[model samples]
Target: MHVKSQRVFTRLTQLKELILESDLFIAEYNLDNIQFVQHAEDLLIPDGKSLSDLIGEKKFRKIHKIIEKSFKVDLRQFEYYLPLLIVNIIGEAILTKDYHLPLDIFLWNFAKESEKELDGVETYASQQQIMQAIKMKDQLKMVKDISKRPYIYRKNILKMAKWYEEESINLLYKNGKKSLGKYKHILLKKRNFIMADRFEELTLNQKSFMAVGAGHLAGQHGILKLLKDKGWKLKAI
Candidate 1:
């Protein structure tokens, strides 16, 4: 076998060993962890930004002009908050005219109705810590690049949504890893391991439902594979 495949086999073997040795039971999972709502509101609902907070007034004006010319958005309205604006763009594209509640919140509400416990893998503080670690320069560059290909923003969203509904794990894994380069470790791997550990501890012998982002269920380091390694039987429903 090639080195990469060999390594994957080794990792899977190791996970099998861990699962065999552990005492936690593996509960069933959904076809895919759907996240119809992008949580863009959480990012944009905070206080407004100022020109100084974004690089500087001069550079901000330049970038804002470029964005306005290309996307026709009033950046000054958001105080040149590129990340939140980009998020809003994607959210708008995906959401379109739909008015349904986000699947995660819907599931949470259902769990509440059933009197089941609700938990998150990490707290809001930890999530913010991860978000704050990304450099501002990278964030700006990302926004600029996406701005140039604005149409692809929605195209990719639709493609992922289709792939997700189809439960195409391999395609989802490939695409999920493509966009998240340096941020992958903090956003995906570390959180997946932490959540897997938490799930093991919390589930024990009880059955539970975990509604995480669809991306979290893909890739070798994803939560599903990680849990599978720990001897959890995951069947699509």
Candidate 2:
């Protein structure tokens, strides 16, 4: 849900239809809730610190160079715009003229929380390893390579979804066989279990439509699999 102008109406219509059919509508975060919005804003920019401050000037400058070179996008146009780019890299919804806030805010907060939690216990060696990984010239080259492929909309949506899901899982759990991996595990896998618990409780008592990021839908520890393992039968619509 990257807020492309062409797909906004289509996505809106689909959401309306789903909402009409369900007694309860659950999203990753309740975008319309003011309290949640405040919380997310605080989490994303804690103590009024910018992304550069949180990541450090040296690391941020290096990352900025990597992204600019790899993606060929100029980030000098605005302050705090790097978060938007980072969000895009992580597959979170992007904010655009056609879309509003809160919807695009939660994931940034979630990502920040993951980093903070990891930072609490990350060893200096592990931190160095993560920084090295991020600073690699080819760190984001794979994304650039993938973007070059021709993809027909709708037809390629499922395939793209599967690819993103697998990549997310691998980054968080499989390839993450280190502290960075643990951070990803907390961000996605652990969060999936928590979300599954709440989703299970809600569905048991009422008809519900739960909308989550596509990345949370598959994988061994994904919400759907967790629910299925708990004896709930699942049927794809």
Candidate 3:
């Protein structure tokens, strides 16, 4: 089903109230047991002799020394390599390259999370490197920029819905971690909001755009069952 939106910041009901009244809506981006990260073991591949391998104890120990030595040689220049290695180690958790997050947030986050010690108190990168690395259509930028700056990055979500493909974004939020719970709900709402934005593209008439945040759409029940139940003869166009 396809659920479309009207305005950017306005509540979706202002655009289409009947869409919610109909509950038998089928939408995309529903959260099923996709198993993104099941067991901690799943995150670890044997570091035998491959890029995909997670180096065992001996190799793991050496990484610190290698990075430390690299930094000693030239701390300022090492940032490029550091973030790359960090992203590699974290399994490319960032959704996309264009995710619009403040660079400082990521720098602080990586230092705290991975090493458990914040490094580079006040350091950033050359604009050259940042612009160079920011490629790959920037889905990560989409989320990051969204979270960091709502007024500026909010519209990107609408653009994403317009140009979407089969590979819809999958957000992995920190639900059980700190104040991130509230933020997680926001992310879910944003996810649903995006689906709703792209509702008109679903192809099926009287369609529904399913997404992660049922809560956001849950309250808008008016539109959910409005189509078929009301005998609108919603069809596959």
lDDT of 1 at 127: 61
| Model 3: residue 151 alpha-carbon error in angstroms | 25
Candidate 2 per-residue lDDT, tens place, 133-230, comes to 34322333423333343132222443444444344444333332332343456555766787788787667756676656555666688777989998
lDDT of 1 at 161: 64
Q: What is candidate 1's lDDT per residue for 89-149, written digit by digit as tens? A: 5434343333244444444444555555556665655666666677666766666565667
- Those runs of model 1 whose alpha carbons end farther than 4 Å from true positions after fitting are 1-77, 80-85
Candidate numbers, best TM-score first, in rank order: 1, 2, 3
Ranking by lDDT: 1, 2, 3
Root-mean-square deviation of every model: 10.5, 10.5, 18.8
For candidate 3, write residues 1-237 as lDDT tens digits: 011222111233431343333322332322121133222222322232222122344543344344334322221232223222333322222123332332223222333333332221111222123323444224223322333454332243333333333222221111112222334333343434444444533434443323222233232222223333334454421
TM-score of each: 0.69, 0.51, 0.21
Task: Show where candidate 2 strays beyond 4 Å.
Answer: 1-15, 34-86, 89-182
Find the 10 residues in a row with the least total lDDT in model 1: 1-10
Model number with the top TM-score: 1
In angstroms, how far off is 235's CA in candidate 3? 21
lDDT, each prediction: 0.58, 0.46, 0.30
